[model samples]
Target chain A: MKKVLIAGASLTKVGDHWNKSLLDLAVEAGSAALKDAGIAIPDQIVVGNMFSGFSSLQENLGAIIADSLMLQGTPALKVESSGASGAMACNVADSIIRSGQANSVLVIGVEKMRDMEPNDAVHAASLGESASFTQFFGISQTAMCALLTHLYMQEFEISRDELSVFPVIAHKNAVPAEHAQFRKAITITDVSRSMPVSDPLRLLDCAPVGDGAAAVVLCSENGQTKNAEAEISASAASTDSLNFFQRDDMFDFTATRRALAKALAFAGLSIKDIDFAEINDSYSSVAALSVEALGFSKRGEGVRDAKEGKFDLNGKIPISTFGGLKGRGNPIGATGVYQIVEAYRQLTGTAGANQVKNAKTGLLHNMGGIDSSAAVHILRRVG
Target chain B: MSIAYWRERNRYYRILGSKCKECSAEFFPPVYKCRKCNSEKLAEQEMPKEGKVMAYTLSRDIITGFEDQEPMIIGLIELQNGVKMVAQIADASADQLAVGDKVKAVFRRVSVNGEAGQIFYGYKFVKIDK
Candidate 1:
């Protein structure tokens, strides 16, 4: 099998880009990434997005973005797996390269969230859930996660303060991250007392809605491998029940656990071998469950371990190296690509203050819905 | 939204779901195939109306069409038939709800699409007095 290498990566600062359209953000990041890769045009282009049609009233994103980038003739398309869209794009690009079909591929993940009203945005986000079952009842995704958090707390006897630690750590790391949305550091007390969006999930506990774009240039192993900062060692994805309540164990994220295990096995590594991880921290409870699913902590002990600083930058296995979804701002479809870009920065020694010292191998976990679909990628620095 | 809600009127009105004839396993929201046995032989069965709150949340940030219904209590209820589901907890305050509180499903208005649009109705749970 031909090895796939991440030739270059770029990201726009994640926030409410009211002035810029979705196409503008994609062009900015895509052009920068292409420039970074020293390639004028790639063999193919893949766009990862969730709700442009619903939020921006724009569809046919693939050709639109391709034409905007001045690569009109390129074979381009969009991949939508809700929040994991970005990572799924990368996974498809990897397959294209490995299949000996395309030597180079440009993967772009972008989301336009702030353009819609808050309630509308919430409705758009809920499109990822089971529309007939979950959304028809007027329950938002946050409400589902809140119920999950409540169950987790009840089952494990975890305190609100302990769960608050995840967001605090995210904000702390975001303080030094330039492209992060909320760079201001927050404390556990602030998270605990923050106005509740859904009971047990305070405002700070959830990833803020924002607009952003991230792009990565991938090429088959050859000349690109010489300059590549990280090699795509492994890529895998898995799925579970669309509705969270249908699962036998509500707290168990079987998709994430399965994806991680498969990706790690492909890379011939264990969870302990992971230097850092970019787990999906869409919600504080989601973060805890993800950590536990990845085997970083014992079952029902993810929050406890997080409170003990096990997931800090210098802890046993650091996570959310670049503020994660919480502080970095979750641009939905763009978030998975953001994780990959951040990993590239860390491996290439460009992550400045947020860099984990001597970090070599990193795991990127991106999920859609409530861990309904998960994409796990393992990247190792290959100088 | 109205059409979709209308399609599932039976499920919403009477808690109708699918039960696997092969294994006798039941599910809410209906499944095409049995999850446990992977059998396509399934039948429409009405789910139990009463259940206990496995988990609950009072959500202030709701989706569109639910703007007027802020701070809504939503619960994960486990029915007596051993099927769990998400439903809005109605006529109950935060102080009145707990993890183990028994509740029964009642048909209620879910949301009003627009000023003069269709009023969608669904099952909402209310705390059952001991």
Candidate 2:
């Protein structure tokens, strides 16, 4: 894979942005990234989002955001793969730069989820699942995850407190993360006792609904953007059964596992080379399954390992360094870009308190709809 | 029924799925290409109604249209012929459900468009007792 450089990166704090529209958040993050890169305009623009038509009552985000940024006539488009939209957009940007079609490409991942009514947001998010089969029955994504959560705990013989550890670690990590939505540290009891969205899966176990945007500017090996902080070594994505229950091994995060394997192979690196990871913890079970899929812990032991402090900032193979989807807040599609921006900060030594020691390599695992689709990218610091 | 559900009435009511001719593999929510043998030769098959509850959840965070069905119990069921599906676990409360409990399909109203609109009917699972 060509070493596409991350010349600039920026993000709006993940939380309720009552005063901003969808385009406002996109332009805010997009302009900051271009300014950081000292570029007047990118050769191409790519926006990653999910359910904008439902949340913002707006579509054609590509044209609208390009015009808003005053970069009309520039080639622009949008890519959506549910929650993996951001990483998938980045993957597209990397391919564009490597293909020599564009010298520089700007990728903006934005979502306006907080503006809608609570149930409407749930409905919008539910669109990520199979409409006729899953969503048609009124089982929201949270409900879908909850069904899996029950099986996971029961089959693995994991106690409630053990399953609650992933959120606990996420909250603790978010305490020092300035851009995180929830900065308050929490305990296992807090997670276990949180209001149940679906039985056995509490509110804290699920990622909070919020609004956010993140952007990154990618320049090719010899592109004019000279402010290269980190290089994207590999980008890989894979798909699984859209219905989680349909999969042969429901606990196996096939997409995440396959994507990570493909990404590591493409980068000529191994799991050992990854210093930290930014995995989608949309639910605690998803987080645990993803960690296990990434080979950080053995099967059915991801939560237990997390409970033992293995995924902490100072511990082995730290994950969700910036609170992840849980503590950092999940603006649906924007969460993946948030992971990339946070990883860029860690690699560039800009991560003040959430920084991992000697973090030379990082992995971003973004999944949509219960690991139905997954995108994994491995980033390494520039020399 | 809405036009969309009207079109898929057979699939909804009969559990119509795909069965690959080459590999003898069956799937719910039918696949275009057979995952087992990559066979495009497939036939529509009705899935077995008898199954066990692989998992279940009492869901409170439902989508807007389902406000009337607050806190619904949904189950992940594995049909007898070795196919998995998600169906509402009707006629049973959360306390009565358990993993590996036998269940069978029952026809029921799954969703309603509104007061004067369409009523989408489909299969719902009921416990087959201990």
By DockQ, the best candidate is 1
lDDT of 1 by residue, A148-239 (tens): 88878988999988889999989988999999999999999999999989989999999999999999999987636347778899999999
For residues A134-240, write the lDDT of model 2, one tens digit per residue. 77788888888898888888889989889899998899899999999999999999999999889889999999999999999999877755758798999999999
The DockQ figures for the candidates are 0.83, 0.82
Candidate closest to the true structure, highest TM-score: 1
Q: What clash count goes with each model?
A: 0, 0
TM-score of 1: 0.98
RMSD of each: 1.3, 1.4
Q: Output the lDDT of residue B101, model 2.
A: 96
lDDT accuracy of residue A218 in candidate 2: 90
How displaced is residue A148 in candidate 1, in Å?
Answer: 1.0
Q: Give, for candidate 2 chain B, the lowest lDDT window spanning 10 residues.
A: B1-10
